[model samples]
Target: MRSSVVQLAHARLLIVGGGAGGLGAASKFARKLPQNSVAIIEPSERHYYQPGFTFVGAGELRLADNQRNEEDLIPSKVKWYKNAAKRLVPENNSVILDNGDTLTYDYLVIACGIQPRFDLIKGAPEALQLEGSGVCSIYLPHLAEKTHREIQAFKSGNAIFTFPAGPIKCAGAPQKIMYLADEIFRKRGVRDAAKIDYYTSLPKIFGVEKYAQALDKVVKAKDITLHARTVLKEIRLNTKSAIFDVYNAEGKPSGETIESKFTLLHVAPVCRPIATVSECSSLVDAAGFVDVDPETLQSRKFTNVFAIGDTANTPNAKTAAAVSGQLGTLEVNLKAAMNGKPLGSKYDGYASCPLLVGGNKVILAEFTPKGPLETLPVNQAVPRSVSYLLKRYIMQPLYWHGLVKGYWNGPTTIRKILHFGRSN
Candidate 1:
């Protein structure tokens, strides 16, 4: 991009996002690398701990808890463009910003996060405008606070939560809100009056088997309707009804529109990587996610480019926890790659889904590429108050002090050492 040079060994690292993964990678790399080595390409002024918003919607957490000023989260050592990258010229190792500025880099970190598209659902294009309308989603941070208010005012009837038929950030978020609704209704003596329905296109409650089994029990015990393989087609705002195309066991169109009247509707909208990054089909996978090695966190095509968080095509469920783990791997591998050496870092596809079952209980689901990788020595499936307390109070401090500051990865090593410390 800068010249015909094969490498800038002195090259500046450019990042394309400002969210958890983007900022986390910049924080780690900027702190670890030499002076003026990293530049993050982000447009937003506020950084959000998106996972926390799920709890915020359920009224389990105050709406204010999910935010941090973007300036505060960024490390002072790196350059902050504070502009959206309009396009990626990866072959040239350059990016063009929406403000008509071109940035050239020796190595690039495509940390641009996924975008939720509510328009995929017919008639749902104007969903956000219906702020007080029955259609609401926890995925949008700005609506999370309103969702709490909407749920709190619910009297009775169908309280529906729908999961779109595609990859979404924080995969368990739809049901997390549903679980919160359950707790809220029960708390308000309205559980009996409301019928909680989890209408998802996914075949299971949670992707990982261990947590899915646990969630299955919770749904059954709570008497919530679990509709698997069901897809939402449209919503009639005037009539206050939803039209769903229900599929049969064969995953075919054994369907007709099933209209359900709703006192509340919660959805985790379908998502895709940002358009700037999406245009580079060479870097993306089938679902328009940047393709990367699950373990190494390196781009499959370009060695100099790596991605973390919701943008990457890695199999792990997108979460800030996963980004924390990937940051460790990417930092190690990036440093090694810079020296023309073999990759030293290995990301185990570590991801966690901290399912807030209720006000005081949580199911901490931690797993890696191989299989169920639990953090707690005891069962992580069953909801526990300890997990709840950690998620609510301790995790935030740990995130700001450790993860965002480039010290903590996932809880993998801590769990292993503590479990085997006395034995070994």
Candidate 2:
């Protein structure tokens, strides 16, 4: 085959992803800019509502129902390049595409999200796909369905779930599936036969103190074992055992290891920035996240570049709800930079995680970097069925029609209204 020729392209604004954050920004900016002035470089044809994967693992929702064609969600005026970003040349405000094309932009939005590293754990990738291997994950669609199967077929023995050491897309998902599986086992009359254990690298169940206190009660009430400061290092498939590296109070490896056999293993894999951005040393930090101003979402090195979602180095929970809160701040600051105005807007590091402790109960943990920023008048730390209903029924529609369409900017407004204008 003949080598393809490289062509140069230009856009007034360029977005480097087609996920939730990128798509939402495109929907808003396309209407504000000249027709076809904005471009999105995304290789995937299908887009998945990743937050729904947890419910899918619990057999509460189907994976297909949460997915849509990427083209369907893209704005009409925005140009979509069905290709991946090969290289980022920020010095020249350009990106090289996988198809031997180059795109230069006046302004750039980097929203390429994180990727799962199943290979980090020995035998995990293959084990997840093996028939009746008793191993599964909720991060991928196929693996999520397999998670349901594994949970359903679990008879008796050690059912182990793990949370990775580093930052993952959704920190709460690891325990969420475990809770759901607990309920399933109870309903199936296998609860007594099963020995459920949770191993997390974090010191506590959750980061926020308010919610962590609530989660502690939940684990105690359900009689589920919690192992803190433990990380899943490797999986032994032939023996169906897992090796964990234990960490002590000093936050270093304690030179201790735990090997446990499992009948069911649900893993939340370690996640990091996608290769395209992480490989660019100048554009990212030591931790492999885009080096951006945490409050303003603007690149520290390149003024015209900004980042959103899991790729950004902001100190917040990497969840879709965090993206919703960041959208307004990112839009305002990006517009300010374009117009040569002072960038005044700031992100409060607000993130929400609906902690599903059971099939019908949820604890809505909403907070900022400072502390809890609960929206409702009631105590959000308490598990409630109403919160579960909101997560189960209302959030999906609101995500598709509101957030994806660029209309929803999170619950800042609702919080104020519900708290009589006293809350953030």
TM-score list, all predictions: 0.93, 0.97
lDDT tens digits, residue span 1-424, model 1: 1111122223379988887777778888887788778888778887777778877887767767778888887888777786788988888888887877788898898888898888888777675566677677888887888788889888888899898776788887788788888888898999899988888776787778888899999999899999887888888888888888877776655657678888888867888988887888888887788889888888999999998888988887787788888888988898888889999887877888788887678998888755677766789899999998888888877777787777778776787786885311
Q: Model 2, 415: alpha-carbon shift in Å?
A: 0.7
lDDT of candidates 1 onward, in order: 0.81, 0.91
Task: Report the lDDT tens digits of candidate 2 across residue range 1-424.
Answer: 1112223469889999999899988988998899878989888889999999999999989999899888889987888888899999999999999977889999999999999999999889889879799999999999999999999999999999999988898889998999999999999999999998999998998888999999999999888999999999888999999999999887678999999999999989999898899998999999899999999999999999999989999999999999998898988998899899989899999898998999599999898878899998999899999999999999999889888888889999998998888964
Candidate achieving the largest TM-score: 2
lDDT of 2 at 395: 91
lDDT of 2 at 146: 96
Backbone N/Cα/C clashes per model: 0, 0
Global lDDT of model 2: 0.91
Off by over 4 Å in 1: 1-11, 248-255, 421-424
